[model samples]
Target: MDERVATALGEAFPERAVDRTFGVGPSWNGANETVGVAFADGERAFCKVAVAGDGSRIARELAVLRYLDAERSIAGPGVLAGDPDADLPYLVTAPAPGRELLGVWEDAGDDENAGEVEREALLRRVGATLATLHAKRFETHGEIVGTDRGGGLALDPAPWPDVLRATIERTREIGTSERLADHYDAAFDCVEATRGRLEGAPAALLHGDVAKPNLFVSDGDGSDPAVGPDGIVPIDWELAHVGDPARDLVRAEDQLLNGFDSEGPARYADALYKGYRDRAGGLPPGFAERRPIYEVVRMLGRSGFIDQWVTYLDEPLESLVDRADAELRARLDAV
Candidate 1:
């Protein structure tokens, strides 16, 4: 129970009394804090108080929630109060329906083969949701409020390839190491040298971080007990941006089906792609050509942030980066 939670809630919901609160979220490890709260008046809202480094994320998420709820019929959290510029930036949102998809996944974790049908069904819905989001179009790829999306100078949209290159470059800087930066540089160069492939990447909505923790499932507004196509609701839009949909799809697969190692059978990914195709009428143009490129780029970005993903490394940063380099080369060759 961090004291910041109460402070942010008090500021946001001065009218209601905050009560019975506990920490919630994947990053509750101290860097960023989120709490599920129940007020004295029987109302509930999710609270997120961003640490200094996470102010922009909180701001972006608040804006994204407003955009989706107001403009799109997406059934995700709605912003109740926000102070993006506050000393400890924070936002409060009405609890969207359904349970966290991670919990559902965990119930089937002990046995990978458990609930195979159920698991694939959920993945299909996740895919359909992605298809639904892809419908929200933008002229150029970049931030939602970018000049391309008709906003002030806060963000300015650019070509898809340009944004992809910029993201890889930024990730490299943020995750640089003398021992590994060189290998990382090679991966970046390959992507740039073959950047012509990205021309087919479309400027579409991307649910920046499409991990299990960010998805929700419910029958409906507490009306029934069934999880189906419309039951799928994705939360956490802080990373949401206008970018290549293929890049987004690959990242989603990384979290949903496989990671860098890619050991497990990609059944979930297959179902997700099928659902996406069924909804979109067909896969995007040049999908086969761009998928691996985006996967390689995603791997490079993940390689940069070793500390964040070290849990999966099971080895020193040196070995992991060595492995990342090899993986990058292999994926590039496959492309």
Candidate 2:
């Protein structure tokens, strides 16, 4: 066990000894570690510790979880013990039942029809879960700093355009490929020209990464007999932020649909929209018009690391860039 985990176990649960520890979930390269701990008293818990970074990421996650726990409507893990401010920040919580949505989705991998049925049902729950998330109010949009005195996030709100430009610029820099570095300036121009679509966007809570792995499916074995329509639980709030709800929802569609396969069924998208629309009342004013642009934005972020996975593709990196470049222009033209 890492010193941080060993020390934390002694401090948090002095009576219980560490049974075993294993790598549990997805983690950024050096940023954090999700560890599973089983105790002598027959209790099991999950702990997330930030081994690197300035602590803001894990701290934000803790704050978000606390807020969700306060709301009590979203079905997620409850914060049993944590110290986001500690030297090696760690959060301990009891695990929710079932498994990751990706694992559940993969069960239908061999059977096409089964995948379709499961995906549609799961997408609907994801949609409703997003509705529950978007219901949490924030005064404005930007990075979440910390908890405010009012038991809400201390937000540093910025104009939506500025946020969009800043994010695009950062992604370009993060892409870090000398081959494509010079061409990214035009991406900035696209955002600069297309800022009108994002103007005056309302701020709301966003589960920044809404892919299959980060979401969980519960059997709903508690007081609620049925798993119900909202059994999906979104985990991993490291990317959670305050932003335009449309941007979040659109990115979610792009992520959840394209995560496993390039072409996911349209009915799954329909199911997701039905869940969000029935709950939120309607789509954002310009979502249909602005969706293509956001799809390009999401594509840019993914393309940044294409070289890492380029080996799997039959075509060269240059080919993917060519297609992405054309798609970018098309999205911009539509705007």
Candidate 3:
């Protein structure tokens, strides 16, 4: 147990004996320090606290959770209690229902009866859940308002080009294998060439990070049952901001396809777009033509940054470079 977290929980819930258990369960984003914890009073809840610098992120997440809880628009974790004054800011919320879709997919792969059906059901639910969130209207957030679908609060897109350029340069400054170097250079070129095309695209209220880990799914199993009238529940609003809807779609598609063959990519892309169109209005004008470019640019920018941190993790840079290269190739083919 983190001493700060322990003290914070103890102070916040003085009446209950809070026992922090160390294990893996689920999280909204990466802000939560303690993984799985069981409170002494038999309280079923999860805790997320900001570390050193940005307590505001945790605060913002708590605010969003509170708003959602009040509206009851979607099924999300309920706030049990929290302490902002602790060494680290923290919030305790009753655990939301359902297993992460990734876990479900992995488990179902081995299951005999519910493999394919479960996977498809989870995917559709994910699509529907995103639509629900995107469909809502908001009066105010940090800096933006209105549920324009593309015009919610978000990190400034103005500096993205420069940020990406700097990230690429920094990756080259650090050591990279020859194969990675070639891929990096090629990806950079693709981004630079397509920069103008993406800069002009419309933005929306995006989940910020919409990958599999952030997505929660339930096939009506376990204590956290699957969403009933609603579908999947999109949690983790830390990165939620007004940004390009295409960006969200791309991220989701990448996770769904998982760098598989071109066939899988196409299938996932088609299914995702169809679902998006069915729920939201039609795809943004010229979305199909612009998607490949946007995806390559975003992937290059992301993978390039991640490559700089490869020293800390065991992830192979070659795989990231390969994916970027494939996305780049697709972009070129599309053009």
lDDT per residue (tens digit) for residues 146-231 in model 3: 12234223333343344345434534443333444565666577668777765555544456556666666644532332253444
Residue-level lDDT of model 1, residues 273-304, one tens digit each, is 88888888876667788888777777755566
Evaluate residue 334 in candidate 1 and report its C-alpha lDDT on the 0 to 100 scale: 77
Model 1 TM-score, 2 decimals = 0.84
Kindly give the stretch of ten consecutive residues in candidate 2 with the minimal lDDT sum: 220-229
Which one is best on lDDT?
A: 2
Error of 3 at 129 (Å): 1.3
The C-alpha TM-scores of every prediction are 0.84, 0.84, 0.69
Which has the higher lDDT value, candidate number 1 or candidate number 3?
1
Candidates ranked by TM-score: 2, 1, 3
Model 2 segments beyond 4 Å from truth? 7-15, 25-30, 108-111, 165-187, 221-229, 259-261, 311-323
Judged by whole-model lDDT over C-alpha atoms, candidate 1 comes out at 0.71
Which candidate would rank higher by lDDT, 2 or 3?
2
Q: After superposition, how far is residue 285 of candidate 2 from its true place, in Å?
A: 2.9
Write one digit per residue (lDDT tens) for candidate 2, span 1-335: 87878877777777778778877754323466788888866789988777763567667777887777666667567677877777777778777656889888878545888778877877877887788778766666787767778877777778777777666665664463545553456556666777777776777888777888788887653354223347877777867778778888888888788641264667888989888888778876577766766766676654565564365565688777776666656665766
The Cα local distance difference test for each model comes to: 0.71, 0.71, 0.56
